[model samples]
Target: MIVNEWCMYCGECAGVCPQCVIEVCETGLKFDEQTCEDCKFCVMVCPVGALEKDEQK
Candidate 1:
């Protein structure tokens, strides 16, 4: 996923992820890309619209 500068670090995305691929850290979010299922739950739940699919991947 692509986490933009608008991210608020609310942990909403990480909470909704069924795959548990997203982690909320002090600095930012970390995505386990290899384990991701491309569910986009994180994208949809991001209140600040920070997360998006990396189409280039």
Candidate 2:
């Protein structure tokens, strides 16, 4: 997933990830692409629209 600069570090995406592959830190979010299932739940739940599916990945 792609986290844009609009991100507020609210942890909403990490909370909705079924695979628990996303983490919200003090500086930014971390994604475990290796374990991600491409569910896109994080992207959909982002309140600020900061998250998006990285199509190039």
Q: Give per-model TM-scores.
A: 0.93, 0.92
How does residue 29 of candidate 1 score in lDDT? Answer: 92
lDDT of 2 by residue, 1-57 (tens): 888899989888999999999988887999999999998888888889998888888
| Local distance difference test scores for all models | 0.90, 0.90
Per TM-score, the best of the predicted structures is 1
Q: Give Cα distance to truth, residue 14, candidate 2, Å.
A: 0.3
Candidate 1, residue 53: how far the Cα is off, in Å: 0.6
Clashing pairs in 2: none
State residue 32's C-alpha deviation in candidate 1, in Å. Answer: 0.2
Superposed model 1: Cα runs more than 4 Å off: none
